[model samples]
Target: MPIDIRGSSASEIADSLRALVERGGLRPGDALPPVRTLAESLGVNRNTVSAAYRQLTIAGLVVTLGRGGTRIAGQAPVAQEGFADTVLRDVGTGNPDPSFIPDPSRALATIAGRPILYGEPVIDPDLERWAQEWMSADLEPASLRLTITSGAADAVERLLAQALTREDAVALEDPCFLASIHTVRMGGYRAVPVPVDEEGMTVDGLRAALAHGVRAIVCTPRAQNPTGASLSAQRAAALREVLGEHPYVLVIEDDHYSMLSRTDYHSLIGPEHRRWALVRSVSKFLGPDMCLAVTASDPETAQRLALRLTPGTTWVSHLLQRLAHALVTDPDARDRVDAAAEHYAARNAAFAELLTAAGIPVRAQDGLNLWVTLPVPARAVSEQLMRRGWLARTGDEFDLVPAGPSHRLRLTVHDLSDDDAGQLAADIAASVRAVA
Candidate 1:
């Protein structure tokens, strides 16, 4: 059955289309008529039809796929970060080992204080002080302002919301972090993919994205997800030079693996850049339940971000902030965090050696997961592993371009025991050979 769209004006047409979607007259992936055709049928100007499409696009009721034409937006599932639900030996979970997380019990006692009232400061004073010193080490102290959010994901979402409007272009890593991809799509912003290599986002890729008129760039300086790529100092410098020309572009650096990373932090935000933010979350070190991240940005951006975090309604729980501050600052807790970092690096290195010996050569990088390149498609290898009593995540799930089957796998083997790790390595080798 054809969609019975009925309207004369843009608002009327948009309302009609929305009603159709709500009533199931037009389903997801169902394309609307061409602008000229729709306008001719409705006896309206072509601009009127185009305006109607824009309204629907902004409302996220429909999607405009360039030459592919506007269609009802599909309700696709967003990829998540955490454990997969399965009885098989799950190695694809993008989670830090629970054993390595610092115990928050001692820190809990230290955070006991009077009940925080609505009129009180949004950020805990002690936490604010500590965050200032920490962020100031890398960001310019003279202009830095801090804001606290639920996590890095929250910060990025709000930052993009404040900096850009719907449908604005944002540059993201090609095999981007799941949260970033989801955030961009849900905000109705366009994502321009910037390719990543062993040294993080490529300079040429960034240049092309900027040339494409991207208003914002989300970068991972270290421990880039799935790939475990860190930004090399040389690459960072080159990126900075390119970004120097576009000082007004909003640059958000999510240093999610800050404390756990083995590499130095190389920022893409230049000192003279006008709008930028650096977000560092404690989830990787303190545990994910902590739900806290600190953002340092220029004074103006911080002020705009502050608008979304109202004092009485949207402020992060002071108790949570205090606990995070205590744990991150305590000597014993710091020691545990340091040991955890070492444990991750050591475990990943050992697993890499085992993989090499199993004929799948890989080198350990600075993240919780290993990005393994295989001889055959990763989905095929993953299926083979499942048959062998294992579960894994294929790389295509992380791709922004959707270029068909991927030859890579992201395995989280840090928590596995020596015996279990060795078995997994052998199984992966066997799976790859079977698929190849």
Candidate 2:
């Protein structure tokens, strides 16, 4: 059996490959012909083959493994989190320290309820009321509607499902949230890379993505993952202006860190944007087990999302929703959440200062993890750190493109004590210097 590339153009080659994949001729993990061999056999330019391969990669259909060559991507990789299962110091897990998460035992006891029948309202009244106030405080004047889902990831999946079709182009940060990357790739959508800087997603990047005809844009306005970059007020306003021209394109702001973020929420959803969703999950502030997120969006989007989460078949559990409401409203719980927020900021900042002193010059802008730029490629540095009995996440894990080797690492060292932080910083500096 051979690939039919006789008179195919770049996109035609991509289409043929996609069809083969769909029909099961080319299985996951199956190897494609080498680029030079395929090009020569097909009587096509090598650049055309390269472009076709690039398309396949963007569509999440195949992956290039350096000298290992290209192979069909088996399945969407589960975004690893909060520590890999290993003996080394687990700094890669982007999870909040268990000690900082407030105990939900009391809230569990308070959630007394009768059996929730299929016809009952999906969202708890109390939870809805609280969410309205919480979301309204940050939004500009608009006709908004509320919807609840299992978590931010669930909300994003549903939002995209309702608004776009498979194979639609979606704009995502280059080094993006794992969940976002996983969601887009698993949905079989084309991911367009938008670069991020210290201030946040770049205006030019967004413009380029929009120019490429992206149907939806997923943005992390504050406490962006991996990099800890937050959208500054100026940056947000500039993005809003660029987006003003594309009012109908769907914009999803995943404010997953929400109350736990030290930076202010600078939203990218402009007032005139017709289709949008702002999702805030309680997992970070309250606890991951709570499994509830509040989404405020245009009424039309809310109505569409509701159709997917009807009462009987797939609504989020009312018990979970009520417990989340109870804990969030409790004064003690609120105070503890606030304290946890402060603690994360302080710990990350302190560790960053130590790294800077060691000549690494890293700073944690915001979020539970610190994104450290290494003097060498992050993978090499991470390998050296492993020799030192430390584990960390390299930035390449979050990239949307196979651009090059990553030069950064995402670390969850905030849970370490001051002495441990100093030692880790020294180890990291040494590892980088060694690798370089």
**TM-score winner among the candidates?**
1
lDDT of 1: 0.91
The lDDT of each candidate is 0.91, 0.88
Worst 10 residues of 2 by lDDT: 1-10
After superposition, candidate 1 runs with Cα above 4 Å error: 6-16, 29-31, 34-36, 43-74, 311-313
TM-score of each: 0.92, 0.89
Candidate 2 lDDT, tens digit per residue, 1-436? 2865444698888888888888888888888899999988888999999989977886678989888899988876577666577889978888887888888889989898898986788889999999999998888747899999989988999899888876789999979998888888778688899999999899999999999999999999988998889999999999999999999999999998998988888999888899999999999988787788999999999999998776424778888888899989999989999999999999998898999999999877888999998878999999989998899899989987757899989999878987888889999999988977
The candidate scoring highest on lDDT is 1
* Tens digits of lDDT, candidate 1, 1-436: 2679989999899999989999988899999999999999999999999988987875568888889999999876678988777899889888888887888877788888899886778899999999999998976436898999999999999999999987799999989999999898889788899999999999999999999999999999999997999999999999999999999999999999998899999999888999999999999999999899999999999999998776423889999999999988899988988999999999999999999999988988998999998888999999999998999999998998878789889999989999899889999999988877
Task: Report clashes for each candidate as comma-separated counts.
Answer: 0, 3
Clashing pairs in 1: none
- Candidate 1 matches the true fold with a TM-score of 0.92
